[model samples]
Structures are given as C-alpha cells and as structure tokens.
Target: MQHRPTIRFHGAAGTVTGSCFAIETAGGLILVDCGMFQGSKTEKELNYRPFPFDPESVVAVVLTHAHIDHAGLLPKLARFGYRGPIYATGGTMDLCSVMLPDSAHIQEYEVEQLNRRNRRRSRVQVEPIYDATDAALVLTQFRPVRLRQWQEIAQDVRVRFWNAGHLLGSASIEMEIGQGRDLLRLLFSGDIGSGFKLLQHDPEAPAGFDYVVCESTYGGTDRLDTTDIGRRRILAQEVSTASRHRDGALIIPSFAVERTQELLADLIFLMETGDIPSCPIIIDSPLAIRATDIFEKHRDDLENGDLLVRAIRSKNVRFTQTVEQSKAVDFVRGFHIVIAASGMCEAGRIRHRLKNWLWREEGTVLLVGFQAAGTLGRILQDGAATVRIQGDEISVRANIRSIDVYSGHADGAELSSWLAGRLPVRYAVFLVHGEEEAMEAMARRAAALVGDEHVYRPRLDSAFRLDADGPVDISQAGPPPRIDPQQAGHRDWNNDYQTLLLDLQAELRNAADDKARGVVIRKIRRALEE
Candidate 1:
C-alpha cells in the first residue's frame, strides 16, 4: 500500500519550453503539461521523440494554460493511444481553440518550407509531427473546469486551478493526490504571469502545497519598471526625435497575445498623457488583432481593463484585422509605430518591416521580450551592428532598445515576494518553464529564504518519492533518456558518420541473426560514441 505519490519531471527542467510532469500513485498515473519543445533546433528535435512515460499508461492530462510551450503537444498524446480527459480553465480552452489550429497551420507550412529547402539542397523528406486533424481530435478531449474547483483527475489525484494572470486563462495548478485519509499536495505555476496587467486579473499566491513547482524566467533579475518606463520614455523621446528628423517606420517585434495588447495599452496611455506626439500606432499582426478581440470579450477577467480604458479615454487604439490594412501601415511611413508578432523577428510581418527599416538611420527597432538563445532578437539585442533579413545582410542603424517592464513573467524579487507571503513550508521543489541558470539562482534564493532543507532542482526523468516520516528518496532509477550530445558541445561526428555507424550495426545484426539481438548493446554503444 503506497502512501504517497511519486512525482517525475519529464520536461521544462533544463530549458524554457516542453513542460510535462507525471505523478504516479497507488490509484493510477497522472500527467501534466504535454507540451512540444520550442526555441533552438536541438530543443525542437525533442518533439519527434517518444514520451518518457507510456502515453497509454497515463490516466489524464491537466493543462495550466494554452501557450505553445505549456499545452501544444497534447494532440500527440491522443495519437499515441492515450484516451483521457484534458482539464483546463475556460479561458485556456477558448484560447486553445484559436491557438491550436493556428499552431497546426504553422507546423504544416513550416514542414512544407523545410521540404522545399531540403529538395533544393537534395536532402531527405520529413513530415510535420501532427496536423489540424490531430489538433481537432485533441479538442474533443478537453474538459473545461472553473478556477478553484478540485476535480478528481484520476482515482485519487484531485487538481484545482488558480489564476496566474500571465495570459488570458493561464493558471497555476494545485494538485492533491491520495486517499482521503492523507494526501500529497503539488502546486504547478504554469508560466506565472505578471501580477498586474490589463485585461487579466493579477496572479495570486497558490495556497497550501506540500511541494511547489514555480516558474523562474525572471529569477535572476529584479522587478523593475524599467521595461515599461524606459520603453515609454524612448518611444516618446525617439519617436518625437524621429518625427522631427525624418519620416520612417518604428518596428516593434512583439508576441501576439499579451505583449501586443500590453504595448497598445501603454502606448495609448502615453498618447493620451501627451508624452509623445500622436502618430498612428499600427498593430499589424492578424493573430494579435483576433486575440485583442477575444480579450475584449473576456473583459470580466481583465484587471481593471474597462476602468483603465475609461480612465485614459483615448479612441485611436487600432487593431488591423486584414492583410490589406496591415500592408497599409507600412506605406504610411512617418512617425508611426508598428507592432508585429513572432517576437524574435524570426518570422512574420515584423521581418519584412525590419528588412525595410533596419538600414535606415531614422527607423527604430524596439525589442520588448526575452529573446531565446539562438533567436534573431537576441542577436540584435546583443548589439550586432548588422543583421541578416531574408537573404541579405542589412546594416542595423535603427536604434535597438529593450524594455523588460512589459515582460509578463515575475522577476526575481517578485518571485521571492510572492513566495514570501506563503506560510512557511517544510520542503519545496522548483520546476517548470525557465532557463537553467535562472532555475539554479531561484533555487538558491528559495532555499535560503524558506529555510527548507529539501529545496531541489530536478533533472529530466528523475522521480521524487515522498517519505512518510522523513526526507525523500532521491535515486537514479528513471526512464532511459537520451539527450543530444551536440547540445552539450561534444560533436565531431555529424549526420554522415551517424548513418554509416547505424548501417554497419544493422549489417552486423543481420549476419549474426541467431544471437544478433546482443548487437543491440554494441549499436547503442557506438551511437553514444558518436
């Protein structure tokens, strides 16, 4: 008779995306956050791999939000024969209806583009992991639950959601799994949002958890209004300056959801306050336009959004819904601010805008998000004097400015403050959605402040078994996982060498077919060597 459930960290341990966790109890098995990998190429490659746990063996999936990193790979679970319900907040479900299909379309288009490039280079064909049909299949499995309602997700595992205020419908989940006699409580902060934002309520403290897995995206930095104040000051200063100097575009690479709308709200406020001379602020992303419309519909959830709008009382916040209207923003030219999506300037209309504006002295490129390690935004943010757009390398004369105050994630101090108010805990486990250095720093802070002797930074596929009377059992038993060696900087052998080694292994197995099964050992050894 097992008394406590075992928790496993499958994803989002070492990197920012691909958040998944499994809780195994005497009653059954439960999983959380079946998300696909994003960011760098090696990270994306994880999407093609098998789940660490048996997909069919998992009982249900509890989603915290609909961000691509949190809930994107859910359809793949269904494809792999898991018949289970996916529970999330109503807002999260609604957002997924739009985002999932969009994700499918983008994936299909990306695969097609990849094939085209591969064909031109004479390479092998590959397939998109899943399509719109798979996404559609996933939609049927979603079971919407309201915030603070604890449903029995599995036989003994009960889960509840609290608003994280990061995005529309985003939540921090509190899960209790056990017989009614006793239980182990686990809290997962799903991309914890900035406590204060328009159109969404503030993130609340997740109460009563034996173990807490918090996000640490801003764990290393202090919460500063620098992003908001600085961006506003620069936009006001530069746009006013640029308006006087020449007539060119101001391109802002933004995230489609919260970031775009936040920019609009701030800029609108700035305009009404007479901080900058009023020029047309064009929100050029179609998805952003639709999301803003959705934001309007879900006004009840927004934190003082209606009152804020009424307080400012400005009517020129533009939402460009059509491509024609978006293209029209580019032609207008002088003293204009254009916010576009796929924030890293990797793809979307922002790229086109950058191609045109980067070489010009009067144009300005404002970066307003955390640029991932390999993203084009990071390159520019790091002060690359010149950057490549499409196929041409263009001079980066446009002033590059980053204001992090608009960042939705909680910063280091905010994270500490959020935890500071919580009742003193016996132990805490930090996990979900952040980079490695950030996690390590947060772990240290949490350990020192909480005075918990068992603060842990879990490795991928590692399991934690809670003890009835004492410390946890930390052991090496876990699913056999293979992370890419190249990712950690050990790669002299490329694809060709890997193929040759595999072929030789196959040939050796066939010739010694009687006892060739033993060569499986050698094959794995050779593959690891490469």
Candidate 2:
C-alpha cells in the first residue's frame, strides 16, 4: 500500500485567517495549525462550525508561529476533546499563554454584543464558539521546542522549528513524515518574515524538502522600497507634523509582535536625534507587552541590532510591563505616542483610544501592518470618512496614515528568493494567506522558478496527497467517514477511527495500483484534452 500522507486544507485557503491543515497517514494524524477564522460575516460564521474532523484523534499539532491566524483555534479544539501535544517555539508558547486567553476574552465580549444585536433583530440565540476555560485547557497541551533542532512528533514524523522572523517566537516548520523506510520531507512556511528586519534576525530557509506548503501573502507583488530611506523620513515627518499641530496623542494600530517593537525603536531613534520631539511612547497592548518582554528575553536572536536594543534596555527607556501606566497616558494628553495591539482596531484597548481621538482633526492613527477585510483598521486605511465603533459612527477626523515598512511577512522578492534557493523541489503547494491576490501572484512567480506544472494554489477544503508520482486528490471522494449528513452525529467521529483508517487505506491502495493510477492519468488526459 502507498504510505504517502493525505493532506487537507480545512481553513486559510482563499482568504487569510483560520489557518488549519490536517495530514493523515497510517500511523496517525498530525495538524499543522489550528487557527481561528477572521474577516467578513460569512467567514466569522465558520468559527461556530464544528471541527471538520475528529480533534481527539489528531496525534499532534505543530504550530508555525503564535499569530492568531496560525494558532488561535487550539482552545476550541481542546474544549472539543483534543488532548494531544501542541508543539510550538518557546517564544510562541509564551506568546500563546497571553494571546490565546486574550482571544477567548475578545470572543466572549464580541459574542455578547452580537447576541444583544441579534435579540433586537429578533434572531436566534447564539453561543460563543469557545471560552477562556477552553483556551486555558489548550495551554496544557503546548510543548515548547527551541529553534533548529529536530524533535520527533511520533514514530515516523520528525519536526524542526526554525525562526520565521515574523514575530518574537514565529517559526517555519520542517516536518519529515512517514516511517524510516518510506520518508517524505514536507516544509510548511507558516508566514515568511522579511530579511533585514529590525530587532529580529532574517528568515532562514530550510534545505531539502520533497514537498512544500508555502504561504503567498505578498507573493504576487514586489516589495516597494520608498527608495533611499524615504519611508523613515516620511514616518519621522508625519510624527513631527502631528506633534506640531497639538500635544494630542498619536495612536498607532500595530500588531503586538514585531511591528509594535519596531515602531517603538524607530520612535525612540527619532526622539534621540531630535527629528521628533521627546514624547512619551507607550506600547499599550498587553500582548505587545508580553511580546516585547520575549524580545528582551531572546536578545541573542538580534543578529545586528543587538547593541541598539541593548542600549535602550539599559537606559530603561522602553515602555513594557506597565498596563496601568499605559492607561494613564490617555489622561496626560501631551505629545505622546501609544502603540497598541488588535492592529485592525476590531478589538483591544486601541478601540477605546480610537473612539476618543479619531474624531479629533489633529490626532493620527498610524497603521503599521496588514488590515484584514472588514476590520476597522482596513476601513480607516481605505480613507473611510466615517466608521462605526461600538454602535457609534465616528468621523475619520484623525490623520490616517500607513507605512508598509514594518510588516513581519516578507515582500515579493524575499519570498521568491527564498523559494528559488530551495532547489530540486518535487512539488510546491501555495497557500494564499493574508490576501487572495498575493497568493495568485506568488503562484505565478513560483511557476516561473520551478515550472508552472509543479505549482498549486489550493482553496479551502482542497486536499493534496503526495507520492512519487506527484499530488493526488482524496478530498472530493464521496462521504468522508468522519463527516455525516445528519446533525449531532458525534458518534460518526468518536468511534469511527476504523472507518477513517479503512478509507485512507483504500485511497492509498488505489493510488498504488498501476491500473487505478492509469485511470487517474486518463482522467487528467480527458480534462486537459477537453
């Protein structure tokens, strides 16, 4: 029987958010990510849906990074009865300790508001997808693994975590699947961070993989350099201009990970050089606070910018571990800067600040990361003259500005160069995350490097089974054993391991058989010929 792995994309296919993938083999099942679904009403609705497969049966979850899109749904999985080990980097583990719980709180709050709205509209009652207790349960499953070291996930699967350079504990996973005699190396690009980023080291490409699942968030477009330090100058000028207008606060909607810290560093530098006045800078999000602490903890990872950060740390200039102080910044109202999380302004303390300052003509909201569709951040980024926040539509009087200079994900060239460096690839599966256009563009560029014949941009619920022949499908096959037409069919999953195994076995058998494989060839021919 063919011993190749059966991979399924449960989420993060068409639009970025809710990143989850499953790999099934004879030995057991391994999931790459268990992230939450974000963006749009329809997409958000998917979070309430039950797991597509048996969460309890999943052997282990290897998380690439701590980004909510890649690691947020573990609590839901845990609450649903998954007790397997959840593997992630030390930094990711720590970040999740803060992020997962915060996510649960946000969910609870959002759901409560949604239900209130539903009641007014005379709609059915709704429940939160998962709670803080569920999130706390998943924390027990996490087993932190350091970077660049190989650790066995099961009898046949060995995994090594490498710093993806996206966030503090962000990593790209290199997993070797199948038993010793029938090994297949698969690499999962969680989210490739850029090269030459501040504070964090550059992304290091893993060598030699039989199959690759890569993220194409910015793959279609080239990285736009403002040319000759223009971005830095723009940022400095913007801050200076705003400071001159009034001593009001400059609230920046930034991801708590790399973006917040990078902005802090830049702001600090501008202050030190007298480019921008010495205004009190606050890293306001608790998640960003914890992430900054992790950045301080892992100072060794700072390849070139070690001394600058160290100097700042020594001077006690960084605003970390001061939540009360962060809140207090709002009252003082001088030429101060506050960088907060929930970058999209969908949720977080940033919302409170935006609610207060956005109507003011002089205040500015500096967007420092990608904003998902439907997020408050995106609306503001698109120059929405007015937007609703917590039932009140506020005018976009604040100076809305975005500087794409500090994104954690790699730009087009960096992604292309990373892919090109990893030569002799058998097949490449492009996972279009962050944005749809980004994924399509990356696929085109990857096709250029490795030939279009070997590239695939898979959509949600698509499956790719890899073998010596190439990728095959087990997805569209009739009635997967775990899935049932009837609602409340938990029995179909709870004790149906045998059925899953048998179906997988049959698929493998059919793939191995020359006659059956020949049918697939003819089917491909008919489609191509048509």
Query: For model 1, which pairs clash?
Result: 166-193, 199-302, 200-302, 227-403, 227-404, 227-405
- Cα deviation of 119 in candidate 2 (Å)? 5.5
lDDT of 1: 0.73
TM-score of 1: 0.84
Pairs with steric clashes in candidate 2: 18-36, 220-441
Residue-level lDDT of model 1, residues 171-206, one tens digit each, is 888887776547677788777766555456668855
Model 2 lDDT, residue 378, Cα: 73
Estimate TM-scores for all models. Answer: 0.84, 0.84
Model 2, residue 50: displacement in angstroms?
0.8
**What local lDDT does model 2 show for residue 432?**
53
Clashes of 1: 6
RMSD of each: 10.0, 14.7
Give each model's whole-structure lDDT: 0.73, 0.75
